[model samples]
Target: MSAVLAQAPAAEAVEDLAASLQEAGTVAAPPEDADAAIEEIGLREKESDQVIDKSDKKDPLYAISITSFEDPALELGELILKGLYEMKFSRPSKIQAASLPKIKMGRNLLAQAHNGTGKTCCFVLGMLRIVTPDTTPQALCICPTRELAKQIEEEVLKMGKYLILHKGIKVKCILRDERWERGERITEQIVIGTPGKIVSLLNMKVLDGGSIRMFVLDEADEMLNLGGLGDQSKRIRQRLRKDVQTLFFSATYTDAVKRLATQLSMDNPWSQIEVKREHIFNDQVAQYFYRTNGVTEKLERLTEILSVVNVGQCIIFVHLRDTVEQLANTLTANGHPVSPLHGRMEAGARDKVLVDFRNGTTRFLVTTNVLSRGIDVPAVTLVINYDMPVRKGGTADPDTYLHRVGRTGRFGRKGSALNMIHDEKEMVVLKQIEAYFDRQGLIKEIPPDTDGEEFEKILNVQ
Candidate 1:
């Protein structure tokens, strides 16, 4: 394992670094154009991020601001720009413009921003730019779930279309139950997979790490703090070349996970763009709650809400896989065609479900927190928390709540989040989340027995 991963503790290291930087009087400054750029992009004021660059600068990026993908500072290739235009991305998003340049500078980075902020493109473009047209893997990205891994691979293929066709660059998505020849080596130029699978491949000599120049961890906080994943991720990084440019991107991070991220940077002079609690909530998402008597009543209310409210796409969050199954059957019997997604489902089934949902074949998706973090679907206009999110110790998981609500209101689109509160525990969780965001009355309760018309009016649905 790498020394940083196995080091005593990161608390002291982070504190020491803070003290040294304070004494040296070198603190991070907000980019002059960041606020103006946010306004230009129509990003909500709460969505702005603060960047901290302690990297050994080849060139300073704080003073640098990119207006478009064609900016000289970004140095995006002609083919890549073509791909961007084909994808309908006319200009750089807030996160993309800010982080792409630092990535181009080849500095190790830890970036935090809200969901739907285009963090995927920042690292995908970086990998696509750095990777040579080769037979061996040149870039590796590890995500927490198979769904997220597949999503990243799709982006790679979409952005690297020209590279794949003209330059013969290949991309691969590695997941469980995907077979590899007994002694064959991975020939893909870019590999994206889960931590355990990637670690296993590295140990078995199936995936070569010597040529990997850029490493990325999406939903990095979960990658570093979840059970067994932290160690597995470390082992994979330990096997990579010492000079690899590492990047960690997540919507939220605990203090402990933030320290772990700093340690993972190793000897590299790292940079970070972190988002505070105040910056995670989207003003475009109107939040509301419904009080029910019990689980049965919660189910009744959810079905009632779906019957009347007109939603383009919706996600219903539950707490357990059994709930997913139960609700899927119940809702279907109640005349709603809903899709359920969870870790226990087969990979093929999950993929088909997500594809159907994204393409408008399915209008409602019921699942746990698996799709809460990095999955983005712009058409989703409503999110129903059938069961309020709670940590294992029965505390409110405010971060998860933020991510779940973030699924809607994506990219400045108007959306709504309706929380179903039944018991005292659920109410407590809701209150804690409200306090976490420091907005005591932000989440208002729907009028008792609100009709579908009244619901639409309150949420300002178009």
Candidate 2:
């Protein structure tokens, strides 16, 4: 077992190196000379310039002003402006400021912004501008997760409540299980759903995409990672008219995601606006790691930590579905009010777990990676990683780790992420993650069986 264990890290290192080398080689290659390539392809400089100009305008992050909603005279309908005012949204977030003007113009957009920077509202407002009450599914928003889609739908309804009340414009959420019957027309002007459901509806001819003037992909990177890019998005695009507008939004811009955007938009100009690195992770989150000797010791330390910490709402992340269930059951049996959330649960059950956690009925949510992205439970004060994520099979990227921890410490609220690592291998991965963030001081060694007072002191719990 020791020999096998020693070989495992070596094998992983080799694989990591090979993947890095492949990526490096690709990046090191020279860009194709545009003039020669265009001439060979029988394209003119004028046409090429148009493409270049468009690309320059669209370069994913261009024209993004630091001032969000700075101009009081920005054009908006009376009802929309009223809604924004009512929602107390006096200022635009970075993403909303950058993307809204272009999106309102019905141009295709590819944007990358951090989570919780108000990317949803950017697309929602854009959708509202183009969609009229009489239109049938004029806009479609596809999110990677059902939770995110539901959340976006709820936000849209909230923002457009006055519109619905005054104008009778209906917005609907189409989940994976629910579908419009064949020959039954869509009455809603705006539709939001996961990719699978949207594709199914499109394939069944129940969704008429020719009428879809706008398409928005929220959390675009996750859509590609989940393997829905080729079939769902491509098929939906094929069904839409040539001039239909497209918007892609994501927190991180991985190479694969950039490639997908380029391919989908016919190499259209894109904007790549990135928030400053310092603003990526919430400074309010007091992140710390506790090193333990083994799983039993880790659990013991976790129980100790929980006993001392004044946790309002907490999420404990584990690697496997079974582990989530086991931990939840263990905590529940030990008098901790806990609920388990995983992909294996029925959608309704999973949603109930979220609702309970959000409503403060369940203080602790034991979950897998399913809840890592776009499940914003703001009241969650602590995120505890009970098991280190396995980076194999692309299951646990740095983005995933960040998202997991990001569950807490949201919206400028003080929070904490307590990582429980038990071995050298786990520590190595944690180091890699810290390096990714340039946060070397975040991890600290904990003595075995740390007392409540000592632990609190270490975590800086007031």
The candidate maximizing TM-score is: 1
lDDT of 2 by residue, 1-462 (tens): 011110112334434433432333211112234234322322111211111112354232235332323332234566776675555565555456556645644446777655555677788887776677775778888886777788888878877877777887789898866646788777798999887788778878788887887788887777766354546777777787666778887666577777777677654333444554334665657777788878897877777677787777889999899998888888888778789999888989988888888888988889888888877776787888887766665233567777787777665456778888888877777887777767776656666667888877766535
RMSD of 2: 15.6
Per-residue C-alpha lDDT of model 1 across residues 313-370, encoded as one tens digit per residue: 9999999999999999999999999999998999899999999999999999999999
Per-model TM values vs. the true structure: 0.87, 0.82
How accurate locally, in lDDT, is each candidate? 0.79, 0.68
Superposition error at 78 for model 2 (Å): 1.7
Q: State candidate 2's TM-score.
A: 0.82
Candidate 1 backbone clash number: 0
Q: How does model 1 score by TM-score? A: 0.87
